[model samples]
Target: MLFNSYSFLFAFLPLLLVSWRLAQGYGPTGLALVLLAFSTVFYGLWGLPFLIMLAVILGMNYAFALALAAPEPEQAQPAATTEAGSEGEAEAQAKTESACMCGSRKQGGCRFRLSRKSLLGVALVLNLLPLLWFKYSAFLAQNLAALLHVQWHFTSPGLPLGISFYTFIQIAWLVSVYRGQVTPQGFTRHALFSACFPYVISGPIVRYEQMGQQFDALSPITAENLAKGFTLFTIGMVKKVLLADSIALYADSVFNAAEKAFPLSGGEAWLGSLCYTFQLYFDFSGYTDMAVGLALMLGLKLPENFDSPYKSTGIVDFWRRWHITLSSWLRDFLYIPLGGNRQGRFMQYRNLFLTMLIGGAWHGAGWTFIVWGALHGSMLSINHFFRACIKGKTLERILALAPLRLCSILFTFFCINLCWVVFRALTIEGAGRMYKAMFAGPFTREAAGLSATTDGLAGFAAMVARWLPNNYIQGWIPFALLLVSFFVVWALPNSHEVLHGRRDGSHPRLGWRPTAAWATGLAVMAFLTLILVSRKATFLYFQF
Candidate 1:
């Protein structure tokens, strides 16, 4: 069941919370078992076969963790602390990256009996094998068939829910064992680490090094945490149910038109693109908020996945902010493993391109996803090159100017918008159609389907009229919500910032509390979101 579903919000979470609280007195193992059991139930609800797949993978990964190395108190540390490098990549950052990819077999990693390196390789493959089979086997086979100029077909059993997410989480765990960044915990804890109900489906991906201790020491479900967690969940529910889903109508229409080879006016293409741009943020951001919030209620903290990515001034800056966990995973496990910025600038650029190409492919098994990754990879390489050319103080001065900073932010956002069109497309040809409409379409007022209005509000109204009937008063909702989203993303403090309060002078009074007013506001949002749960609209990132 989805976290936003009626069964989850009204039944599962309440029962789990009560059981978790009661089990706390029974000790850590008992409490952990309660969570693991609930997590199994939650995932098993999806399908028994998939749950079996998860269980088998978790069992194998845990065995690998135990086999690699027992927990060494002296060696254990957060994986992020393990000499993950940076120099020209000052803008690149992540919450948890791997150190296992470092060190050669001969010169380093001498601490092995029964060929630990070989075992680690086996474990990594074991984790990846299912993912490759279920998610990409058909994509791979089809491509191979095309290359051989023969008719060949491969049938896929379809993707298991959260297979991609849990695969990465488990890979990070097994590697952490090799790196001695974490001691393998008990089987129950290891299973629960990746299968935690709140984040199991869509994640701000957690690492064992960080979450291991939290699993062992789950804090009690207190009123303070309850208030905060529920407050955040309510906020996220509204964002997904109300804003993201509402705006998706506009985006879906335009994208559907483009996919069918329908010629769109420039205004229609841009309007669709912009709507989806906002929709993606609100959807993912909303899910992140809900995941973090729910985990908090269980007294386990998941790292922040986003930090106002829309405001990023450079591609590098955007990576650091958006999908913080996955980027960090790619950085530590993939990027650095391939020799990050350690080599000269050219190798760094090559690594950046390869890293992003792989990153894009990680999203899906389509050529369109590969193109998305390639675009970001290219952008990242160029961003690094530009930064390298400018000296320290000169770069600082350039960044310090408000006008340049604003321009940088706008430019980065614009580039991201173009790339997102490809990211959202059904196929390469469809993306080209949208791109043509966006860039190469006629500029004349009549030709481009202009409203001839300079007023921003009027323009949005006119834009909506193209797809929506003028007499449909409700047609204005998406545009109205999109305008509200602008204020929310750029101006308002995020869920984290609201809970923690801003570091800057602004929003001095923005902290969340258990006061009556806060409860009332959250109650209203929850009620509204609950009523709209009939849509059963899955979070967008769930597909990835």
Candidate 2:
């Protein structure tokens, strides 16, 4: 059920769009149900067992929300009126009315709020249980067995697709309900929010408070929105099929060779790592564009996930741009609750470290991810410390220098590239091997004993034996493509700018407009994407 797949492009999406439009005539509730039913079918495509698990989780959360939203019985004498006689009584009555208006309870008010808080806590744990069991149980068990020196055996449960994303969404929803930030919707609307297929697999992680009103106000499909969505989807398809997948060939070759204990020359190591860095960026960001486009087609607006992260001048800036939604989610739900920056500097650093550590582990059940998270966390702490050293006038003067800014950007990108090696490796040992080769191994072919290698068809056999090494591409073709990707990422406007027809915030660039010429271009991109879709590569974030 990948959005890039033929069945989704030619069959599921077309049929679903048609059915959704027709259902709009039946009114909002009917349209919502149609979406919910379609989302159910989409989820079921992954597996019935996981679908059933999702349904149960949704039902429990809905029930908990209903309990949280239940109204209390009115007092017999009406406390406000009864206490209106004396001045002190009137003051107390005013406070009571204020509390009620603010959606809080006073004395003799609903006991349901207390009970609901407990229920919400239980619901959060219950929802996370499936994610823990499926995603992390094997890692935990194996580690425990090694520590205890036991020969215990355990079979891993199949991971449900999008469990990490949906689980976070559900947790956010439950917390919002408990905090009275979100108004409870009917089962149909809630179900649609929980299972919306566009972002279910790889998400921008939309919050209920942000999107609830959009869900309620279902506008009729318009030509403008449809065109915008199609354009975004086309652009995303080109990024994924044409760019990301192509780079993945070189990256996979080198990494897979390393995994098989092959010694890599320094050139091969760096080439592979750089290829992977761009591959991951385009892969995840490209998927996000497609998701946002799909939601737009259905008349829903999702939050932007990326903002030219590579242009960031520091680790802190990088986090702000890369995976914007997830970073915000972690800040609001995890960091803020743990006292955030309101606490002392030491505590703030501690919170930052812990948040990233957990965030890394959430990506997958591996120590490599943990170390990757720790590296970023440490860099962020150091960044903050460095900022503190040049505060006020000095900071402003330093930032005004363009060369310094460029150097910072380059340094930050290099640090990020090193982290990606850890993130992409199959194991920590593989990561070590790759890093050793990247930093210390010989760079020249003569030094590495490959100076006699031939060119053209004659060399194909040797290159094939070396896992079809990246050098097989010949000439400047690969470098040309890499240059093109850099131009698109750093020089060209992003998808958001193109959609909005103007620069939005820090994204200062030109945008696309509806025109006959643009339509023809989109059609060609679509055709090229279709030709490449036969390769059927899954989006990178799908593993999480």
What is the alpha-carbon lDDT of model 2 when measured against the actual structure?
A: 0.82
Which candidate should be chosen as best, given TM-score against the real structure? 2
lDDT score of residue 254 within candidate 1: 85
Clash pairs for candidate 1 = none
Q: lDDT scores for all predictions?
A: 0.82, 0.82
Of candidate 1, the 10-residue stretch with the lowest lDDT total is: 88-97
lDDT by residue (tens digit), candidate 2, 1-544: 8889999999999988898888888776777787788889988999999899888888988987776665432323433434344555545544444324244555744223334556677788898898999999999999999999999889999999999999999999988877788877787788899898888777989898778888778766788889999889888999999999988887888888777777675667788888899999999999999989988887889998998899899999999999999999999988898889887888988888888998899999999999999998888888987787777867768785999888888888999999999999989989998887776525333434444656565455444344323442345656766787888887887888877743434434346678888899999999999999999999999999
Q: After superposition, how far is residue 127 of candidate 1 from its true place, in Å?
A: 1.6
TM-score, structure 2 vs. true = 0.87
TM-score of each: 0.86, 0.87
Candidate 2's displacement at residue 33, Å, is 1.7
